[model samples]
Target: MMNALAKQSTVLDLIDEYDRKAAGVEDAIKAYDDACTAIEMAGTIMGTYVNPVLRGKAYVHAREMQKNLLSSGWKAIYSRLNIDMIASARDKKLFERTLADPPPLTFENAKATFGPYLENPRSHILRGLAETFAALDPAYKSHSKVKIGVKGLPKRVILSSFGDYSGTYGRDKLRDIVNALASYRGQPLMEHVEFNAISVAHRRGDDAILDGRVYVAPERYGKADEYQTLDRGLTIRLFGNGNAHVFFAPETLKDINRALAEFYGEVLPDAEEEGAKPRTGTAVSKDLQFYWSPQDVIDRALEFAGIIDLKEWRNNSPEPSRILEPSCGDGRIMDGIRARGHRAFGIEYHAGRAAEARAKGHSVLKANFLDCPAKPEYDLVVMNPPFYGRHYVKHIRHALQFLKPGGTLVSILPATAHYDHGELKGEWRDLPVGSFAEAGTNVPTGLLKIRTPSPSTQRATSW
Candidate 1:
């Protein structure tokens, strides 16, 4: 009975194989029929007289184009997948066996090769298609060069009208052709010999069109199908069998590069390296609520608080010579405080930022200010707290405890900080919208000068 079961299983497997082969043959016939229909339609539109034999030849040529397109598409798509996926034993073997192979560009082939992965409906061919698309430009309008195979017996190229409802018909066709030809070359061809003919259609209007003529069309025009839409002088299409066409405009090329990068999961290096780096002067840490106070603002706040006479501090030492600035990112405010003939201490939350402050010869405590023990020894307290909701209130209330009796506190806080929090009160002056621009924020801020009352004035002025 076991032997009979084994024999029956083998027979069933053979039957399944037979059915698969039969289905493949049926699919091939259908693909040929479709190719014939496409060739006939193209010839009819172009007014090319193709007899039955010529039609057969055209069918072969069209199939080659299709093959090239699909091959390029697959190559692009596979190249962008994560290394783990590509390096799997199964995929590795597939890749090794097909190194010089441009898989035949056909629906039947795609179905056979990719059916398992495509079982999930989310599988797509856009990236591979974009690679093929990028290959069509004779000048290779790409920052990074990719070789496209172009092994073919074609001095003259075929021009097929891509009439479809899809908005990306031109881009899709170009990718198809590029991939097809690239695969044919066997070796990668970074530069491509120009196409025989290229034609594209876009909408025309002098109206308020936001996306340009290529993207927008009328109600009657199903997107990308109107061939004559190019006749309105809105588009430039390639024509005749030539090795030279034109490169895309800067903006168009930019958009293409951006799209390709997204498809390939790549981030292009910034062309202008200078512009890419953050401007250190204006950079601030929002998480730590560290904002760099400008020298002018520092001077104004100190003078307004009546802690340091500007003329006296600049010329001689002030009465109370010690200053504290908690959350001193980069220590710009601390630097200003020291320049005014006063000793300054800073507590920076970020170690990296604290190091920067220390490098500039400032005393930086690399710890969160809230966690630090307050000595109440400092004569002045200055802080720019993070205004993420009501964080400024928490920081300000804590900072006040660090100043001694009759000591002054100067803070550059958000406008809302004054009205919402009544923990500490003093003379307040509203600053401009971009007053803290050096700190990398444009939130409107106010300068507050609050002084803890002396023993004598404590009773006169209620707490």
Candidate 2:
């Protein structure tokens, strides 16, 4: 009888496994059908029934704005914004699917949504902050920094940075950090720490010499290259023989000790204890929020322009070339261009983000793209241009002016603008991309590949 019972258990386990696999297949099929059908329908109604291109662009940009609002304030703003977008779309099929696959959320399992801004150095400087979070908050885990909106208040920043490259480079790379007084936003995270100038040694013709190799990264967002404005330039440099040299700031020692203390207080509270509490979006909690990651727009641009094949790029576009993005947000598209080992430049409208972009080792400016003068020469144009603008007519016309004859204009625009707007007349090959509504978390649901013809071939189509 016992052997018979064991055999019964094995059979039941197999049955469960088979059931899961079957469900997975079903979801995949449903998503594929939904996306493909939606794309076909969008093409048919470019000017009439459904302008998915417009709706898709609206969703992506709105999500970016939502992220900004939440960071300026708390969770409710981010939560309500995304939920409202879903509601507004009223995609009956999408709503039903979401209900079927309700997110497994929990405060204990939640993580902040950092998006693609991870390529920046400020992203790295937040390591110490996360260490502190583990020490101070029991429910928090390793997650991206996010902003949330609070009621009766404008907005507020919560969460901390996700480890990026800032920490590796020292003070210059880190943009946001608390100052030496253990202060943040001109307030104190602590009273103080003892400061003393100690001898940092290095070999000098076999004799050790003293050098000041000390610095402190902020506990939060603080600009380093722009430190003069804050009057917080604390790092010092020491030069040596044989052209040998080093740079250091003193606050780093104190910062290390603080992190060590926090680490002990928090991360070690329940050490050596691990159990499966449902890992992948499986927890049920109130605080877990939706996360959005941006696309590799720059890389997509290369493929869209037919500059190189999709699988292998650097080898194909290795020739010294110029690349540009008009509305680059946090270097997502710009970084892609840089990866191809080409000279790249981008224009962004937000001041703080422009600075943030520069801090991430990018050549960026805080200026409206439309106001900027065109360079009149670039090999390729890769942009997911802003959809909400009438003045964009001039912006696109100017951007196109910069491109050399035969240069590619790989962009994402609302299909409605492709029809209704009084701009963008050219011999264009539209590569119709379907919505990843059910697949891509936060993304351009659809894409149009635009090509600008030579002056002689251009026709002025009245809109």
Name the runs in model 2 displaced over 4 angstroms.
Answer: 1-293, 296-299, 309-318, 389-391, 419-422, 427-463
Cα displacement (Å) at residue 90, model 2: 18
Tens digit of lDDT per residue, candidate 2, span 294-350? 444334546666554333654544565676777665776666666555556777776
The prediction achieving the highest lDDT against the true structure is 1
Give the Å error, residue 126, model 1.
41
Candidate 1 wrong stretches, greater than 4 Å: 1-290, 307-320, 419-423, 458-463
Residue 77's lDDT in candidate 2: 25
* Worst 10-residue lDDT window, candidate 1: 226-235
- As a TM-score, model 2 comes out at 0.34
lDDT of 1 by residue, 370-423 (tens): 888878887888877665556666677788889888888888865555644545
